[model samples]
Each structure stands twice: as structure tokens, then as C-alpha cells.
Target: MKPIVTIAETTQPDGTVLALQEHDGRRFLLSDNVQIASPATKVSERELARIACAPFRPIRQPRIWVTGLALGELLEGLAESVPQKRATFYVAEPSDELADWHREFYPEGTFATDKRVFRVHGVDTGALNSLDSPLHGILLHADTAPLHPRGRGFFEDRRWLSVAYDTLQEGGLLAVASSRRVPKMDRNLENAGFEVAYHEIDAIPNARRPKTHHLWLARKGDYTSHAH
Candidate 1:
């Protein structure tokens, strides 16, 4: 086995050291304290994203907010899963190193050549605050679980959840893919006023292990925010 190579490192304001590691054709981005945000070998994470975006009934030219564009698996899944041909993806990824890896590794694939993806780089949920219009769906696959610190207090702060709640068009969907299921995560989404559903998938595709991957689906509301 080849040793893990550190590609890029970022220091959080809290003095946390986050490093991106490459090994066996996969990239792992995480803080020194926890392991999360790996798109290369985290096949289960991709599965989680796919599961989160279920029963898709997107309106015309539906706009999707993808908080994490890890290797563009979710984007690929979304672009393939949705019936609509016209769609736009707002990709919020704070790591420049990761984006570079995406480009170098998958130039003509999911992230690079996809005409629909728009990348946003920020330390936190900077992209979520500014909304030109109500969105049809929002998919979050940040460094870790929703309660993790990678989002710059996105899940830690209730106001951010409210922003998500308000930004969605009625019947819109919000999905999150996480390595582990945090305590009270479902309750927190409920507090944010979303009808949430939970799913557990394999941590790695075709690998034998307990179902550890977590996927949460939250619908905005029953009626369309726009005219029916």
C-alpha cells in the first residue's frame, strides 16, 4: 500500500489542521481530528447522495444547490436521475485543492465538462445565503455530518437551516450524505420544518460491512412555492 500523500492543507480559524490526502487514486479531505470528505474511494457516500435524491419530480429547469461537490458523484447522479434535461447545479466547495483534483482527475467527466455545474469556493456556507430565487432541491455533502464543523457552523446554527427552509420552492427537496448519523440530526431537521426520511447504505460498494453511511431526505413542503 502506498503511503498517503498530503496535497493541500488549510488551517481553520479554530486552529484545526485540515489536510487533503491522496492514496490509491482517492482523495481524503479532513481535519486532523476526524475523517470525512472523501470522494474518491467513498463509494458509499456517492450511494448516499443517490439515495438522498429519490423520487425526483423536478419542475422546469430545476435549480439544485449542491453544498459539496466531492468528485461530482452527486452531480452525476442528479444530472442522470432527474427527468428534466435542463438543470443547473450550484456547487459549493470550499477547497481549491479538491476542485483542482476534480479537474485533473475527471476533466471530461462529472465536474469539469458538465455545463450545469457552477462551483462556489468559501470557508463556510457562503453560497447558501444569497438566493436569486427559490430552488427546487438542495443537496449537502460537506466534510462530515450536518452537525460537523466543516460547514462553518451551518448545522450548528439554526438560522442557516431556516435559510435553507425559506430558500426552497414548495415541494423542493433537501438531502445530506454523511459518514455517520449524528444524534438528534433528524430532530434538528424536523425543527427546521422539513419532513425528513433516513436511509442507511453501505460504507463501500460491494464491500462487506455494516450499513454505516447515512442519507437524509427532507422535503420543503406539500404545495409548490410558485403557482400550481
Candidate 2:
């Protein structure tokens, strides 16, 4: 196995250095206290497979928006599973170096090169405003506010939540995953006018071990809220 090499560094709130590492060929973000971010290789491809294949009833090819492009695994999985020729993907990320690293290190056939995929902005996700047109689906994989520090600012701001709500079309979906269980996540989605469903992805058979993740699928229209 090749030794891990440090690529770029960022500072955490506790005055700790967050290091981006490349081991063999895989990249990861680690801090002194914990692993900040990493590629989702541990989770079985089946879990992502289900998400990618989730039924979507779009009038035309749906316009999808994704925040936190990470290593592009989710994007790649989604592109492979969903074959809407008229689809468009809008991606947002905070780090330019991470984006460059993704383009350089990831495989050539990955989702980054897809013509429909667009790198829209390089800014903190908390500052993300409303989308110009309603989106068919919004995928958030970066961080969950109140559940994770990276997303704390977003959870604290109701305005941001409202922006997300307004960006989706009726019957649109907002799918998110968090490392830790967020009991209030469903309620928060309900408060934002979405019908929420929460499930543990790793609970399924043949799922990845030591890779606990919570999947929240929220819809914009008529369904009843599962939160209580």
C-alpha cells in the first residue's frame, strides 16, 4: 500500500488543521480529532444503487441540483442509474482545490465529465441562495446542520431552509444523508413544508459495516409528514 500524502490543509473551528490525504489513489479529509470527509467506498454500491434508481416522475428531463460534490461518487452513481437524456446537474462546492483534485485523480469515465453536469459555484453552502428555476431533485451530501459541525450555520438559519423549500418544484425531492442520526431532521423538514421519510441505509442486508448513515427523503408536495 502506498503511504498517504497530504495534499491541502484547512483550519477547523477548534484551531486544528484539517488535512486532505491521498492514499494509494484515494483521497480523504482528516482532522486531528476525527475523519472530516472521505470517499463513500465502504457503503455497498447497492445502497447508492437504490437512491439512483428511485422513481422520478418528471414532466421533462429533470433538473437536479447537488451540493458538496465530494469525490464525485454520488454524482457518478446517479448519472449511471438515471438515464434521462434531458437531465441537467448543477453542483456546488466550497473548495477549488478539492474540485481540481476531483478532476485530476478520479477515473476518466466518472460523472465529472458528463455534459449535463455543471460546476455552478465555489462558495460556502450556507450562503447558497435560491435556485433560478424549480429543481426536480436536490441532493445534499456535504453536511447536515445541527447534526454536523460543517453544517451548523445552515441549521441555525431558518431563512436558508426556506430558500431550499422555495427552490424545489411541487412533488420535487430533497435527499440528504448524515453520518450521525439526527432525530430532529425529520421535524425540520416538516417545518420547511416537506413530507419527510427517514431510514438507515446501512441496516439493509449486505450493507457496509462501520458505515452508518441516515437517509432523509423529503418531498415538496401533498404527502403527510412522517415526523411527529
Candidate 3:
């Protein structure tokens, strides 16, 4: 069997170690010896982005905000689905080191050099508040959201959800992906004045241990008539 080699590492403020490892040409990030990020889910993450942006296909220059830049899979997906030259993607990632790591190590994708992608080194609420115009979509993955740091997260906070709800255009969407279903999160989205829809996706279609991920699509307006 081949060995997993750690190509790079970063130490968190709380003394946790984050190591970037490669095994058989596949790269992954591990936090304190537990896998935190991997390209294994790239297909699912891309699909999540594609589904999230389905409502904006008819709109010109649709603006999207992504809560995190874990490996840039979501950004790649967005770039693929939204091909308009004027489209914009605002990526909010609190950790600067993560961005640096991607730049230094994972430089294969155009997401790193994509002119439409804007990097915001901060939290989701702050990034959303700083936007001059409302976004067409807000993308977030529950496990990779930048708001979590050993406590209650921005995704879980009602105030933040309200901000997200208000930051979006009338027919905009708030798409959230999670490894498991959390009923409270669904309720929270509904309580935040969004029309919520749930979807179950296969993260890995033919793997030995098939994994399912949940996606919640919340809309700000009565745009269900235009849903794709």
C-alpha cells in the first residue's frame, strides 16, 4: 500500500495542526489528524453550486457569494455554470493561510486566477454587509463555513441568517450543503423568511460506502415559477 505524505502544514491559533497530505496523487487537508477537506467531494460540491445557480441562468451578470473557499471546487462549479463574462463571485474566507495554501499548492485550476472571483478575507456577515448590490445567490457548506470556530456559527445564528436573507436580491437563493440532515437548520431557514426546499444527493455515487449529503435551497421571493 502507498503511504500518505503530508505536503504542507499549518497550525491553528487554538493549537490545532492542519496538515495538507497527498496519497496516490489525491490531496486532502487534515485538522488534528482528522480529514477536514478533500477533493473526493468535488463532484458533489460542484453539483451543489450548479443547483444553487439554476435560478440565475436567465439573469445577466448574476452575483454570487460563497461562504468558504475550501479547495475552490464550489468556485469552479460556479464559473462553469455561470459563463457570463460580467458575472461575479464573492468568496468569504476568514483564514488567510488557507488561501495562501491553495495558491502555493493547488494552482491547477483557473479559479485561482479567475478575474470574476473576489476574495474577502473575513466572515460571511461582514462580507455580505459590505456588498453594495444584493447577491443572486449565497453558497455555504455547513461543515466548511468560515463562521465556525469551536462555538455557535454564523450559519446557526438567526441574526446572520437574517443578514443573508436581506443581502440577497428578491429572487435570490441561499444554498446550504451538509453531510447530515439537521432539522433545526431547516426550521431556521424557514423562520428567516425563506421558502425552503430540501434535496438529497449522493456525494459518491459508486463508492464502497456510499455517502449522502443534504442540500437546502432557500429562496427570497416567489420565484418558484422560474426554478430550474
Candidate No. with top lDDT:
3
- What TM-score fits each model? 0.78, 0.75, 0.91
Better of 1 and 2 by TM-score: 1
The numbered model that scores best in TM-score is: 3
Q: What lDDT score is found at residue 87 in candidate 3? A: 89
Candidate 3 all-Cα RMSD: 2.4
RMSD values, in order shown: 3.5, 5.1, 2.4
Give the residue spans of candidate 2 off by over 4 A. Answer: 7-19, 31-34, 39-49, 57-59, 107-111, 122-130, 142-156, 203-211, 222-228
Candidates, ranked, TM-score: 3, 1, 2
lDDT of each: 0.67, 0.60, 0.81
Give the Cα error of residue 224 in candidate 3, in Å: 7.1
Pairs that clash in candidate 2: none
lDDT of 2 by residue, 85-150 (tens): 777777765555556766765647354478888776532334345356677677765341112344
Clashes within 3 Å, all models in order: 1, 0, 0
- Candidate 2 displacement at residue 186 in angstroms: 1.2
**Candidate 1, pairs of clashing residues:** 170-225
Whole-model lDDT, model 3 = 0.81
